[model samples]
Target: MATDSEKLGIKIERNPPESKLTQFGVRKWPNRWGCPPSKFPWTYDTKEICYLLEGKVKVTPDGSSESVEIGAGDLVEFPKGMSCTWDVSVGVDKHYNMG
Candidate 1:
């Protein structure tokens, strides 16, 4: 089934299969962490694929009224040039790759 993110053109896989993770070499990706209860604006210069290891977050694309909620076990892809605001309600730990 398609998620809200998918509808917005953001790709998200909820608890994808292990084979998919291995195919993507997710373990080799760099890790990032963020503290909770914070908000920040960001713009992606390149496409990014990330797998969340923990925490919850809400990302609202610029000029959009809806927000996409993400949390542990979600694998998400953000297309290049997408501007957004990240609201972290729980701390985050994740692995990410950019291209």
Candidate 2:
């Protein structure tokens, strides 16, 4: 069964499980496949787990204006009340299930 999201040329791996954004009451995607060479604009999420699957990204946590490089095989647990930006440098492909 294909979904509207699966047609985006990206696939989400379901394994790590889903999580919830306690602050905003929003669901966080446990995995996400950002388009290749795609640049995720400056946005912030209260709580989420950014897992690297097949690319590189730079994230700037809220309060602290510093961008950290995230690569494949790496996992980042962004705490709540944290605002930040994401810049996808390389391929963006991940499996994410949110709460």
Clash count list over all predictions? 0, 5
- Candidate 1 — what's its lDDT? 0.86
Clash pairs, candidate 2, are 12-95, 13-95, 31-95, 31-96, 33-94
What's the CA error at residue 8 for candidate 2, in Å? Answer: 31
Instruction: Give the per-residue lDDT of model 1 (tens digit) for 9-82.
Output: 67889888888888999987766755767899999999998989898999999999998888988899999999
List runs of model 2 lying over 4 Å from the truth. Answer: 1-32, 42-46, 62-65, 97-99
Q: Please write out the lDDT profile of model 2 over residues 1-99, one tens digit for every residue.
A: 211122111222222333323332223544455676765444323444545667777766546655666566544455544456677778776544332
Model 2 collision count = 5
Q: Cα lDDT of all candidates, in order?
A: 0.86, 0.49
Q: lDDT of candidate 2 vs native?
A: 0.49
Stretches off by above 4 angstroms in model 1 are 1-5
